[model samples]
Target chain A: MPDKEKFFEQIVRENRDKLYRICRACLADPDDAKDLYQEVLVKVWLHLHTFRGEAKLSTWLYRIALNTAILYRKQQNKHTPLLPQHISELPDASAETAHKQEQEVLLQKLHYCISCLEKQDRLIISLVLEEVSYKEIAEVLGLTVSHVGVKINRVKQKLALLMEQQAGAEIELDKADKR
Target chain B: MNFEEIQKNWQTQQAPAAEAKAGGATAESDLLVRVKVLQRKVMRTNLLVAIVISLTAVAFVFILRPLLNPNTIWYDVGMGLTLGAAFALGLLHWFKSMPWKKQVNLSSKAYVEQVLKKLHYLNTANQRLTPFFMVAILAGINLIYFDIFWNENIKLRLVMHIMLNAFMISVGAISLYYSKRHNDQSYEPIIQELEELQQKLEEV
Candidate 1:
């Protein structure tokens, strides 16, 4: 393979999961996430020549990925209201152990909570979950490091509240089913 | 569950490796082809617009001069200024939208800020230039025909001159109003979003 092609493939291999996770977190629909992921990769490939080594490749990827995802969401919003997927609709975890199954369920709940966030919040939280440093997140988002920290705290608190509400609603539903 | 647990699980979950690889290679080539096609289309369109505008400007200068007898120097200057302004504006637009400038590889924030700054500058420049260009063109056309009204014996010449001036002025005014309104409507939201993003970044 040519040098550019090899470079692209290397970047894709290293950051595919991060890009997809960011897309998936921002968009509720898996199909949309897939489409956006493909779009982001294609964009990255096309602009690969512009990668000046001033920032880490991952940071550059995050910038493009986040911008594409945000723009995609805005375009999608014009035609339809964005709705978070119900937790029941999530794919079943095939883990044999109960502990793994519980973890999978919690992960799905976390995804649901993320999907409920506003666009910027979703992006900030997704990067946080990816273990991106606060300063990097700030650079990726064009915000100050201090602002990124505050936004992350606010987004985490919001997610905690959303998860609690979801748990409460599930408990009430369980009681109703017993009745 | 707390964020740490969610984060741990997020890291551990399997990425769809096979699917990503399969889809990515095809998508990359397909995107390259699309980009090439788009670049060709834009170049073709720019060439076409330049040809059309050049032809129109030349034709108008020649065609309008013959309509008046004993044409004055103002007519020549007016026509020259009008067509010159039109061509300049057309070239400015083409240069602004050229594909080369769109490929900056800056960090996300810097990239967004760069784009926003470019857009703001373009919007402001276009807004400032449009009315002045329109008025100059209109004045040029009127000057080109000024001698016709002064020297001609026919009532039709006066009537025609008045009617043409009225039509041009009305069209210019209406277009200026709509163009400004449209620019504001289209750009304000994006500008607001970028500013909000900036503000979020700046929050201490």
Candidate 2:
């Protein structure tokens, strides 16, 4: 009802998916991602007053979510899972078509490949996937726009290679299964 | 899957579906309450600590002094020790409140850099502050019985002073060693991580 509560709710509702996805992108564990998201929210609420309307709220939220994840995962170095163990379930998989199922598999592979890149690269690509502009990504990451462009190119190439390797491995497994 | 295609799918994907997704209005209200409660709790605890410290200092200076009838220099030593302790607590308080600084709005690299600076400053300040206080307090304690004992047996007073000083020095030195070790152990990993992040962002 109060102004602060209204502002907090609005911000959370608006950026809920973005924050959750950022957490997911950076951390390999869903539980850890959830924890990181909560920590980010706690920070946002605590530091709500410090928001001086300088940066867009989403950009500010991105900075907080990401900075928290980097620092939080610094303490959780041992929890890294080398697989795409994070892709638990496709949303409403049973109701979707076979084409949708194939898309889900590719999405799974994408998650796996994203998990394989460097931590900062993973975060940058997540923002890039969200259609965030290079300038905003640079701002969120404290990088030059040109550097973001450079890193995105590199990460995208790496991700593509990783995905190709992953898909090739999957096809081999399928052939073996057929044999 | 092509990069452009995956990028498109990423946008259309329904959700990673965070586990904390509780019912809408109720859950948000609960979170708001929890955050507010936590903020209030920290403030209350800090206030209580400050009050208790003030009360103890007052009781020591006013009540204990008149009751014991010690030398005037003894009171000065007590005052010095109190001020030393207050100074340490003040620095710690500042450290706890460091996050509220206006730098939060800075970009992530600048934010991490600033945090690293503060952490390094806190570490160095702690390393320097501890020994400085140890020496100051040790001097104060060593001075305490001096005016009284100095007037009497010079050898006995010298022996007592040396014993007390030796005890204070040994205790202070051991604690200082452990304190510095603890600080490094706790701060080093975080500092290392922040440095790595800084480098990652700084790299082209």
Candidate 3:
């Protein structure tokens, strides 16, 4: 109906950031995150016409990004000798050399915590992190708003416990270095 | 800071702010490129398979149907194969040229799901024609064997007919059994994967 090329370019330009952030959320390493981000963009470009406008564009985008990441993860698991660098390649953590080590430490813990979540919980966190409304997140994720709220609270608590444990480990390592 | 506080801060500043540099290429970009390449490759493979299978099927039809009758010629076989190939190739081209690219979206899940569905439909259609395939092969074999038997002026016609019938029945039975078994196992994985894909979509 619309000029196909123009419509696709507009959708890509408009939603690129959100898509990129979701990619970063799913992937651990920055390089891998960036790679996943671009992949999502290309997919969005190719699939933009299917948008149908039934849900918010963000929800639709989330659907695509999450599915792609999960498929990629599933595929990676099938191969032997998972790449070591994959864990450290997160985009935000890898961007600055000075903060890279600390950011990586924090991200590694975050990664483990997120991975432990149920698929629905992971969707909630990704959406919440992207600053989507609780209602919108529910709509995008096909959950009740109350259910989303409760899940978000539970995930937040779980993440807190995980971060605390990582913090304790860091303190122990600091003490050993001092000794 | 507590994780909640840090996460809240992180969320507030998350994505919309970085919209300015949306055009730049990043490492994540590479993964996307690879995915596109793979998608195209899969599409090509599917087209090739459809063409080859259709040609083989049509060729089988021509060879078997005319063997009992004297009207068909060897050239009919070649013509049938060519026509089947051209028809299948045309359908493949139509699908490829369709704006399937615009429907791919952020995950490529929808497109992949469509591709899987197409494959399943093809398999089912192919399976439905399988009985015809078996009958045609047997008919063709009988005609050729009859020609040879007639040419040799071979006697014991009762024994030859009985043996040929038994052999055809046995072969048909074996093929049907294996076909059912293979189809069940193959379809299970695809159905399971499609279910998983649906679950993932709902979660999204």
Number of the top DockQ candidate:
1
lDDT per residue (tens digit) for residues B1-204 in model 2: 566778788766533343334223224334334433433554565577677767867876698657756655765675667556665756575565456344353434455677677667767777777677767666666665574464668889899989988998899888888977866766676677667656744551
Error of 3 at B154 (Å): 37
Kindly indicate the candidate among 1 and 3 with the higher lDDT.
1
Against the true structure, what is model 2's DockQ?
Answer: 0.10
Candidate 1 deviant stretches above 4 angstroms: A78-85, A90-100, B13-38, B41-204
Listed per model in order, the count of residue pairs whose N, CA or C atoms clash below 3 Å is 2, 0, 21
Ranking by lDDT: 1, 2, 3
lDDT by residue (B1-204, candidate 1, tens digit) is 567877888776544554644354444444344435444554686688699888987677677567554456776787787788777777876775573346654333444466567557657767888777777777777777775566667787778778988999899889888978866765565566656544533331
Q: Report model 1's chain A TM-score.
A: 0.89
lDDT tens digits by residue: candidate 2, A101-155: 8777776777677777888898998898888999999999888999999999998
RMSD versus native structure for model 1: 13.4
Models sorted by TM-score, best on top: 2, 1, 3
- CA error at residue A4 for candidate 1, angstroms: 1.1
- RMSD value for candidate 2: 13.0
Backbone clash total for model 1 is 2
Residues B58-156 of candidate 3 have per-residue lDDT tens digits of 655676446544343533443444444445544644464344455444333454466456546545644665565556555555554554455344565
On lDDT, the candidate that comes out on top is: 1
